[model samples]
Target: MKPMRSIILVVLLTLGLFMLSSCTRTDAPSESHSIAPSQSTDNTNDTPSATARISFVSAGNEAGFYSVEEYDGHGIVAYIDYATQTQLPLCGRPECRHSDSSCTAYALVENMSIPVLAVINDKLVIMQTEVGSDTLPHISIADLDGSNPQLLCELDSNISISPQLYTDGANLYALATVYSGSGSHLELYRFSLKDGSYESLCSFADGVNGMITSCFDMSLTLMFTRIDEESGSVEDYAQVFHVDTNTLDDPVISLTGVSEEAYTIYNSTLITLDTKDALTATMTFTDLRTGSSVEYKTNALLSASGMNSATLNVFDLWDGWYRITLNGDGKFASFNVNPVTGEFFPMTLYYEDSMNVVLIFAESGNNLLVRAGWDETRDGTTLTNLKPIYALISKDDYLHSVPNYTYIEGLDL
Candidate 1:
């Protein structure tokens, strides 16, 4: 199957909609120099309180099922049995086919709004925006078993939340496009799940609606792309913004990089790999907490094959880990990487291969969920995948290169 992010971006940018996009794909290396925040005059020695990284899980809860979205807008509840390598709809009602609005396995899809799945504080949360029939977009809460859905709240019809959501279990952080008589602005919205009070934390680039390059508890790094509505062409903005997630005040730093795809922010540090070529490049690591930046020369740590392919990308992972994915034409390779001192290795554990587009879907507890897409037949251009199956391998096994994994079979019927 094709990369999920690419497909979404193509559709949004294609229609010239100033909607929020997600890196929800790229990664970084290490650097040194005089780095700075835009609004702050603080020197390199000034360091704010260091916050721990936030753990983000997929819509798939710990209860063994994933709520996957279909093209028709409803989210299909797939109950997966890892040991048996099988999956089926989670609807428990007898004699019920997993289709139509009445099916319990299908999430709420009213007025042409797609249901987005998220597990917040052990409660299955489904957020939907009714863009067609009504302006009221509501969030619904369900049990871990995918039953007893109750109305949580209806959002402002004008503000649309992006699918990329980050939560600390108590507070949820979302990027939404706020529409008004003026135009649309991408604002980061923070919601208090307890009392249901919400506030707009910060607004990103004025017309800038793009992707989350990296996300943390106290900070979120974002990259916006300039898309021409007339031509439908997308260009990556030169500056990437790292926004503060703590306060309502506007405090952001812009890191000018060679390519947005090569940037990654973690542990209050920003990394950029300026590639001279597939084999040669320069890496920079900037500690935003200190305002100090460093640069170093580097080269590709993997094999020579497919090094020149244009599908190269870097993505920040849980903790200090980073992922380097190189996919193009018929070649695909993923690696566990570190730009400091050039330590890198291929992702040989899980479903690592050149035959299919293997993806790290999300993190679940102590294990990382991995999957590849499939279809009865693929459209040559879009490469759409019909069935999605996933499995889990211990995070320790993944980072350590141990090949133990449990697979789930995606039912064709």
Candidate 2:
């Protein structure tokens, strides 16, 4: 009986090999448009796995001419396209303003074949997917000449659709959720374009199971954290972890200090600042080779008079610098912190009244994109009177304006 089963297995394997060989063809698409036979090569070394460039686009709204209404509710995707500037719409429409409740409700167009937009060799490529579906996820690949988008691949099952997309040169990564027994589980997956394959790099379970609030991918390593809610306390804890994809079996190496609320990791440094209370903490480099931790702390309250406010706002952190907005007695002020030296300095950026402001930090090539905005501004002259406007900070210290009244388009791929 065992011999018979082995023979049957061998027969099945032979038939499968035959079918796979017959399906293989040499007419696959190439980077060029010529009708040449596809050359067989190892796809593993096809593209470098690093961020060649970074791009930004706004959520689809009416003001932008080339705006895409697909990203109405979801966060905007940054694609790099140098041929022509594309516009993305903002969240609310004039008539449907009150109807939209959350940013997640916007209809999004998914393309998995070719990247919607990409930066290859410093050239921006814009390609759209030929296969259209509201249910299935696909991508389209093309160059910057508005060429026809080539179908790359289609994901059919057990996949969480991500509206937030980013790429590290060769492969693209996105935040997706998988179906567990009780609820969904959040995870990050790496998708390869050359082989049309994907693998889960990280995951977090439900409940106090360390949910990912944000991530930053630099070089071959990924620096991210899990935001876990305390069992009884209102405060949350952020556990930072660094993963190197090169070692798939053992990626995670070091962990950082836990925080009560928001934190940012950059250049191997961790910054945690609490808004409601005047408290800030910083962690030095956590050497993976040796388990060692270095930490620094400071009182959130800067001035003796400003300590009375119950609520504050921490904005941006890059390299070792931090930006924070403080509000008290109906007044506001912005301060910068040097995490290395624990020095705090005031900045001219501030908002008046009590409007909420959001800061978006993005890196484009050697440039750093910083966008700041408030609900309303008080006349717009004094730091106290002016509302937050999006500011673009370049590597050369050049600042550009992300106009509230204009449209911006592009992708990171």
Candidate 3:
């Protein structure tokens, strides 16, 4: 199957939008620099904090099973079998790597390999694909140990599935793309994990790049960007509306000229990536309830780590900073972009060959957690099997060598 993020086509937004055509000129190479870790000016001197439990998926010996291992910077602290849907009895031994090929956690799932998308409420939300079939992309929820797998819903193979999925206590949410003769549209769906059912929450003709649903005026409101599919576009704007009502009649806020795909609403402020050209997108911030907005520019916003493809907003905010990962181009690097200053801070840990390194979770001012795969491949492009790996980078040593790692030999499927 195709890489999931490419189908969304958010970051690869072309060079003809008004944001691109109106640019003063292309940026010179001097403005772009490979930021090394030791050069970070942001408090990289603080003492490294104690290691804590962080969640990651481990490849199992069985065809369809992956172990959800909780590592404490040293060894497995806790683990759940991803395929059997059963939690392995806590291995009585400490410092147990749990790498034994015969470990009880290994189980089979009819020879079908799935990628764990989200671990919610002790269950695994996985991306399901069929062998030799490229069109049957769907999501399934299985017990944390990988048992009782249930198909939640089938997805449009044409639309890309956002790797960043969300859950609010009871429902699972996702953003996807839909293309037809009329053009492309951004759509949202909510699956009721409890009932194995889902609903078409909404769609945006302006094309959605990123989205967040939060309580506004005591009700849930969805906030996102409305971007034009092409240059000379008229639909580019920042918008939000109540989830219970039709957005067609909702009043449009005053925010303007924003790419819908590169934004997030944080603490009542709408942060968006605004660019007239592909090379110099400005990270714009606007107050949703007020009529004020702020903008910051950076070259890093245009491309990401691996294939130098495009940037995908991971929807994480750290102490007034936003996190984004480079997707598409098979490049691997994460950036902590300040929405207020338009400055980009590239993480030090680099992934050779693959753009699979992502900042999955983080603890501000302490440690940044990342989920990645480590294999013999220096570049991730041609490897059919990758060994899953996880690491913790120190805040003081974001560019320092990875001080800790947990590696499991398995196919990265």
Candidate 4:
């Protein structure tokens, strides 16, 4: 856990470590997955816990969810109490303090092994390994609360499960990365838990790098970017790849098609910016959930409005937002785009001749996770680097242009 600090992002971002497979459950989308990111509606009454308050609170599922607690260079996992909303170690041993490796909660962390916390469907599935425990990482079966654990199956590689996982009922989509001189991509090893024997299928994805949202059944919405082999420049904007997650049935890989450096698949719609004409552009998005054909009328609308180009940047937020950069006098002017209503929101980072530029990390519930960075300068010399802090704010507050931020203390990792 100390040297293997690279996986801290995966551990903390669980929001809660339950990647529920899209099984025969009739739950809403909110209750179907685990994730984290957000900003300043931080409750002032939040009593300080010994562990870090997970930036993204996972309140979707009520059966209790798992997350990480990285304290004093030591990484440990904990489960949030459903009633009291307090963080507690996974160890259930009577009279046993959880400070040492003897506790089940700290054993894996103390051994310095990579542990992936996930609950595939209704059962708790923890892929972990201890120093003297086993040679290879094994998937274990345990109760929903992770009691009386038994071996499930040994993973061929070391246990390094990504916080984000996708599944379709019987299969657990594990994460992997493709490396080359060109770039890396987000890869998935679809391991089956119940479709007969132990088998895996690599979900096909074509991109230099990618981030998957969820495996809504057999489909995944990926925000990826491809490197330009000719120009050698990474594309200016992100591209969306919505493809079949399981290629077991059909050997042929089915790609919905890549957009012009900019695309987004949100809600049930998959939209790509059509930039064939330099004078104007059009965006026609199809609802993959319904599989309906979308016609072209947005291009005509852009042409009628006399716009310059179709190149845009899509921000994969809670819903969807885009930004269009226009050539300004000295700096590039970026404006946020509203796809549905075709409205634009200018992004001016300064007011009253002062500035406080902020970075948005994630959106959780009605809150946003943002960090404001600024430097103090006096007597012609810069005083410090970017002094910033993680905070939470209501999405409604941000939408209404309120700048009040509730700074959280322990979100720096």
Candidate 5:
């Protein structure tokens, strides 16, 4: 009886090992769908466990060409080539009008396989996390094409519970949510990319949840939302903090207001979107350095019935243009807002399907990198089929002529 019991246990262990192996295979699809990059020739494009935080960077060797990361979220992070429609470099929307033929799509990092959080300074920042594991995620750096992998640092266990890493120029910052028997709070820390040394910059007490939204124009900003147990409702208010990159400790300016829909920092000005009602909204531009602010109110935001339930959020701020996205009901749309004048203009996108999913990646002058997706007409909350596609669109074409007037065909995601 003892020998029989031992044999049964052995067989079960063997079966478990095989199941785990099957689940860990690379996600790259068939060769027909995969683009094999020069540096990464391997096929491993599994769907990302999370969304990829991507940024655009120059390939250095190629003139007028740039690259961005395409990740399945957990397994594969690759660099893909991006170029203007013409052979020469065009920066502005008026100049870089790429049709299907003008822009080229090629793989840059396909052979490599890893999950990364950011692409900065021509390098990939990888984060390794495990479930219920006491060990903190080990951070590693890799080349733009997923080459030359190097370990940066293992974050402190106390601060790495749920860490969000960000970089500005050469410095790295981590925003982590830490909890204790008393309650949960948020901590902001700075890490040296060169050696991975870190220091706690500030802490927000009673912060149940928070996010480090933007680090631009030599400033870092964080948003925090606290919950009240007695009310059994999230507080209508939120806290926003701003600090200069050079001076992280000395003085931190705080702003309190209604929870923000979206925010961006440009030229030291922090612009926030605050929706008032169905037909109206306010955009507040506060100078992070000076604390001076100017608010612009618009009535064209809400629907006619005044029953609009859509949520308006600030997507990305580039140059002088701020991308504001509206999502609700069944459709989504993106508008480019001029922060100085409070002018809103629509960027007409040719929706392949009407599921209303849109993502604005980056902007070069007037050209916007956009990814649009849709799920088969919803049967309540369940979608039958899902489709995502990527493209480059010029703001001028949509503003001057007609929305959806010009569309660039490229990779299908």
Candidate 6:
């Protein structure tokens, strides 16, 4: 009986030892393991499915107007819907005097839309006009939806002509001509949308010719060609002026021997073409704040003639480059320019008659809204009608567009 009891005790001791060994192994791992307090707390709340929120707005058309022609020999403003390939009429009755025999016929010969459309603080300001006498040249200012097209202002009676209208974020600038005994002389004016006031900035005695053109803002400055009327030649001279919207002063400074049909400004740099050979002569970047200038010459990507009939517009794409559009031959071609190197490369090519193109930049230029024209497919080359194309190029090289939002991102909204 003593031996049997001893055996049972031994067996019990072995079982206890086995259980103790297992418990020891488990406790050793817990003691050796060291988890940081922060990590342990984070593990309690950290979600494995966390992600960032993103949304996008469709791009609006930059080229708002297309073919302005008269149908049946009557003056008509053909507003094309590029996305849908539809046409809308402006005013075609005889009361408007838009007939074939009329001197001011809607020839559609030069259907140039505003080079840039701006949305200032949510107000859609596009440059548009109506068929009327030169004495009463009518301009239109409406919301982005083309509603409330109030007769914002009229051209100066002295000029009796409608020069091309250019707008910055706040003001619209125009170039008009008045006939003097010798000839017609060019004049520049600024129209304030805030107060419906027109202020003359510069007027020269036939020295400056052609339509006055500008990019960005008059505050940034404007570029115009000075011509010698006697020779009917461009003097290879240009003028750059600082328009103080805050004051009514003549802001004209002489920039000699720089004749380019079209140009644009980026980071205070002026990229212009010298019509000498239809090439981009030299890129002159002027720092407005510092009053400093830098010049560089690069190989011509597109010819000056190609740029002329074709709307050549440049926009800075936050990533230290420019997206350029050459809207000629009833087609659209996009190219990218390296701001640092002045190198250009073809980006995208689409068939459309781009009358005008504007870039809408927000957040100091992080995002972009590109608007242009797309004409109706007629003969595989020519666009029978004009329409609009809105392109939104994302920072990640993604592009999106809508049917008729010609201008976006900056206006009043």
- Candidate maximizing lDDT: 1
For 265-315, candidate 6 gives per-residue lDDT tens digits of 433454453332223445455554466765644335555224544434555
Looking at model 5, the pairs that clash are 27-45, 27-46, 28-45, 40-111, 41-111, 42-111, 48-72, 48-73, 85-102, 93-366
Which scores higher on lDDT, 4 or 5?
A: 4
Per-residue C-alpha lDDT of model 4 across residues 224-270, encoded as one tens digit per residue: 44455676544322222222423323211122333332344443455
Error of 1 at 73 (Å): 11
TM-scores of the models, in the order given: 0.67, 0.50, 0.48, 0.51, 0.58, 0.47
Q: In order, what lDDT does every prediction score?
A: 0.51, 0.35, 0.40, 0.42, 0.41, 0.37
Please, what's the RMSD in Å of model 5? 15.6
- How many steric clashes does model 5 contain? 10
**Per-residue error at 201 for model 2, in Å?**
3.8
Q: Model 2 RMSD to the real structure?
A: 16.1
For model 4, what is the C-alpha lDDT against the true structure? 0.42
* Model 3 ranges off by over 4 Å: 1-116, 127-138, 152-163, 176-186, 205-234, 244-268, 272-284, 287-317, 323-347, 352-367, 371-373, 377-385, 394-413
* lDDT pick, better of 1 and 2: 1
- Summed backbone clashes in each candidate are 15, 25, 27, 11, 10, 24
Query: Among these predicted structures, which one has the highest TM-score?
Result: 1
Ranking by TM-score: 1, 5, 4, 2, 3, 6
- Model 2 C-alpha lDDT versus the unseen true structure: 0.35
Q: 1-413, model 3: which lDDT tens digit per residue? A: 11122112222100000001000011110101211111111112212112211111122211112233322221121232222223232233333334442322222122234333344444555554332144455666655443456777676556555443444435555556666676666677666656656666677654455443332331233444444446633333334543334243363332444333344444455555543333455656676667587766545555544343454443434456555554444444567666666666675555664444333332223643334444444455665433345443444444333445432223212
lDDT of 6 at 309: 44
RMSD of each: 11.5, 16.1, 15.2, 12.4, 15.6, 28.9
Lowest summed lDDT across 10 adjacent residues in model 2 is found at 14-23
